[model samples]
Target chain A: MATLDINRVRKSYGSMEVLKEVNISIEDGEFLVLLGPSGCGKSTLLNIIAGLEDITGGDVLIGNRVVNDLPPKDRDIAMVFQSYALYPTMTVRQNIEFGMKIRGISAEERAKATKAAAEMLQMTGLLDRKPSQLSGGQRQRVAMGRAIVRHPELFLFDEPLSNLDAKLRVDMRTEIKRLHQRLGATIVYVTHDQIEAMTLATKVAVMKDGIVQHFGTPQEVYDRPANTYVARFVGSPAMNILRGRLVASDGPVTVAFETSDGEALVSGVPLSPESAARFRDREVLVGIRPEHFTMDTAGAVPLTVDMVEPTGPDTLVVFSAGGADVVARLDPLAISVGTKARFGVKAEKIVLFDPETETRLD
Target chain B: MATKSLARQRAMGQTFIYGVLALLALYYLTPLWVMITTSLKPLDEIYGGSFIGLPQTVTFEAWSKAWSGACIGTECTGLKPYFINSILMVVPAVLLSTGLGALNGYVLTKWRFRGANLVFGMMLFGCFLPYQAVILPMAQVLGKLGLSGTIPGLILVHTLYGICFTSLFFRNYFITIPDELTKAAQIDGAGFFRIFFSIMLPAALPIIVVSCIWQFTQVWNDFLFGVSFTSGSDSPITVALNNIVNVTTGRKQYNVDMASAMIAAIPTLLVYVTAGRYFVRGLTAGAVKG
Candidate 1:
């Protein structure tokens, strides 16, 4: 296992730049997830790390050695494509042993390695079956088996679970996590699914428009996104950014905004002393996660429930506030639409952004 | 009564379809039937009264004479040596063209470079070029290379021509295979030819059969190239059969001619009979979805 570092990486096609100067580094055995929507160049970054695509400018160092000019095989990386990419005609054993065969490994050693990989993947019975004969999950296991047999220093996964059904995707996600812990190999996994990133990654790089919007631990990215783009992209039902005026008085700081009723005030707003002094009475965007809004009877804000969605575990209540729609995840309470309810924001969880720049204020 | 009439109508539709298919099959098989029957007949029987009928005395004499004794343009050598020549020419030609075409298809689709489409477009344009257009220049090239009237020259000409179709077949076939497979192979340390042999060629069984059968039929049944490029004893079986049939001196040996035609046609017939099942289905199946 080896640490991977990408320094000032940029990719372009003539005049069209896909990846702007992006830098990210991960320690050995840390799972780094490049998360973004389609065309956001997350997969391009993964391919750049794999040496499958050339970078316009930068260095990708594996084990602290610059490997920018090495071929994919020479870089000691194994990739699991989104399609699994198992050799269709070969059986599971042959697919696992193919790399060793190409490298001229001895037959007995290849077979032993194949057997160990198949056993680890719990697919020993499928060793003789071709890829077409295997189910989607089995094919994914075989792909993993192929990569495991290579024993490369780094593993690359390009949305490997995207092709599976929802239930299979969940199972394979856990399976991949288990494999990562067991193998302890450095991995760069690319996915658009934020939950996969949240569950599987030690470090998450939320990308937008070829730029790294946020690069930190998943909780850090989730609880404290760097900007509005990441604030909305990393969460389900998304964080609601409501326009409001910040008021810093002698007692405490509070944000007041227009509610369905006259005006609503969220007091005890958390901010640094410098931010409190600088933005004492300035316009700001208040960011509140869905789960951070609680049903408080004595809260100052009154919101009319516009829509309700019950996702079995929690209820999502949509309301209009500060001239934008807001979603609040509440307990499965028997709340009806069009009802005026008072909700309070958790002070510690609230993030304030500068209204002009849409960046975090503190 | 309604159900009975419906059943009867369905039976009638089936009968009509079978009737038309049977008539078409018989229409196509008539020449083959006549060839088999006339080849079994003695020359005297064919000349006298039983031109299209079963021979009064079926004999192997005509078949044996057609095999080893018939004269063609005063060489008096039978179609045997020419049949061997055609075999020598067709096998290598089919193999080489198919191999080259497979390589071309792999490169055009997988290991692509700049101007790949232009190169493939030029090859596709070569597919529609008339055979007569290239014969003069090809003959000149053959003469310049000291391969004029040789079996190897014919092999070279057929191989060069066959690459267009074979590459077309293989490129279309290989394109259906996902690019991820080769990329995965590359990461697995397999080089260019390693991926071709291990991944591509194995998946290419159906297309290989298709290319071989097509090239074999085209090269085997070609009369113009065989006749124009070679003469006398060095000719392929088609030219030798033409020599056997177009005699200017004596009565036409219709039985020997029929037997020689059947002999020359048997290889392609066997090729089709054995490999035709894969022709339609093989091109569209394998290597992508599941």
Candidate 2:
């Protein structure tokens, strides 16, 4: 196992900058996931670490040695690609043994490793089959088997489960987690799926527009996003943002906004005295998660449901609040469309942000 | 019922399609059948018989004369030396050009560098130019290097011409391979050469067979380059066949000429029969959606 340190890595193609001064450090045996939307440079960062792409300016350290100038083979990293890249001409056994054979491992040792990998992946019967003859899920297992047989210092996975069906993706995700635990290898995984990032990563780096917006544990990033972009990008059914203004300044500030019916006050948000003095009666954005809203009879805000979708376990209610669309995850039997529903926002779950800068205020 | 008429109409349409296909097949095979029939007839029968009639007597005399006894100039060495020379040129030319073309394709598709597409475009343009336009300059260069009129000169010409098409064939096939495969190999600690040989080359068997067949036929049947480059008995069999049939003021040995033409075409016919399925598969594999 090895610790990977990415120090201020930047990438550009001619004049268009793709990655800007990105920095990430992973400890030994840590599962680090770089998650973002397409064209967000998450894959670029992973490629840089693997030495497949050269960084415009920065250094990558693998186990105390700078690997910025080293080739991918010399970096001692194994990668599983989204396409499963098995040698089509070779049988499953030969595909797994190729890396060992190239590295000049003895024939006996190559055979042993191939057998053990096949057994571990439960692919003993598939040893003689070619990749074209294998089903997609079986080919994926063979791709994983090929990587693990090498037993390299670090493992790289580039959306390796993106090609599988939903059920198979879930199964392979669990298999990958178990393999990581058993091997205790450092892994840098890239995926655009937020659920995969949350479930598989020890640390998640959420990115946007070629910059790291926030890097933390999944819970930390979900609960305490650094900015509005991070807040909006990390969650499904994304966080709701409300336009409002601060109406009072004190130890416990009150932010008030005018509903169609009347004015409503949201309390218990602690603000710095200096920020409070500047935004005494100024407008700011308030962010709220879907699950943070509760069904209370004495709720401060009354919203008319525009749509209701029941997803078996939970009901998603889409309603208009503060003249903006707000989604709430409620009990399946809670409400229906065109009904007047009252929801109370918790003090701790409410987030305050500057409307212009989009940074968190409190 | 009207449904019975609709079924009969569909059956009629299907038969029309098969009829058209059979007509096209006959159109393609007619000349080859005529040549075979002409070669089997005796010399007097060839001169006096109807072009499409069955021969009165089937004889091996024409075949024997074409193989060893027919006169080309004062020498009666027939077409043996020309056949030997053609084989010498075609085998090495096909092997070298296809091997290099495949390597070039592997590099261009997987190991992309700056100006890679420009180089590929240049190669494509090379295939478009008429061979006659470049033959003189090529022959001059070969003569200066002491390669003109030799088997090596013909081999060099064949390799050059074959590369443009062979590389094109391999490149188009390789482009269908997903980039994720190469990226995955890179992450598995494979260098450029390792990834190419171990991964890309093995998956390219169908296209390689296609390239070999293409280059073999092209070099084997080439008349212009062979005639322009070498003279005397050192020329390929096509040149000898042309000299035999086109001789003015001499009695045309129609039987011997037809027999020699058939002999000259055998290598390509054998190639087509052996790797025909792979050739069609390779050509159409590009159209198969990944």
DockQ (Cα-based) per candidate?
0.77, 0.71
Q: Which candidate leads in lDDT?
A: 1
Number of backbone collisions per candidate: 0, 0
Q: Model 1: runs farther than 4 Å from truth? A: A248-252, A272-282, B286-290
* Candidate 1 lDDT by residue in tens digits, B1-290: 99999999999999999999999999998899889989999888898977766778888777788789888877776789999999999999999999999999999999899899999999999999999999999999999999999999999999999999999999988998889999999899888999999999998998998899999999999999999899988899999998888973678888888999999999999988888887655655544323
The sequence of per-residue lDDT tens digits that candidate 2 reaches over residues A1-362 is: 99988889899999999999888888999999999999999988888888889889988898879999998888988888888888878899888887788788899998899999988999999999999899889999999899899888889898889999999999999999999999999999999998899899999999987898888899888887888998888888888888888877687677776554456577876677877888889998888889887778677766677889889888888877577787888777656678775677675677778999998885
Q: Using Cα atoms with residue i matched to residue i, what is each candidate's TM-score against the true structure?
A: 0.96, 0.95
Worst 10 residues of 2 chain A by lDDT: A256-265
**Fraction of native Cα-Cα interface contacts (under 8 Å, chains A and B) also present in model 2:** 0.79
CAPRI grade of model 1 = medium
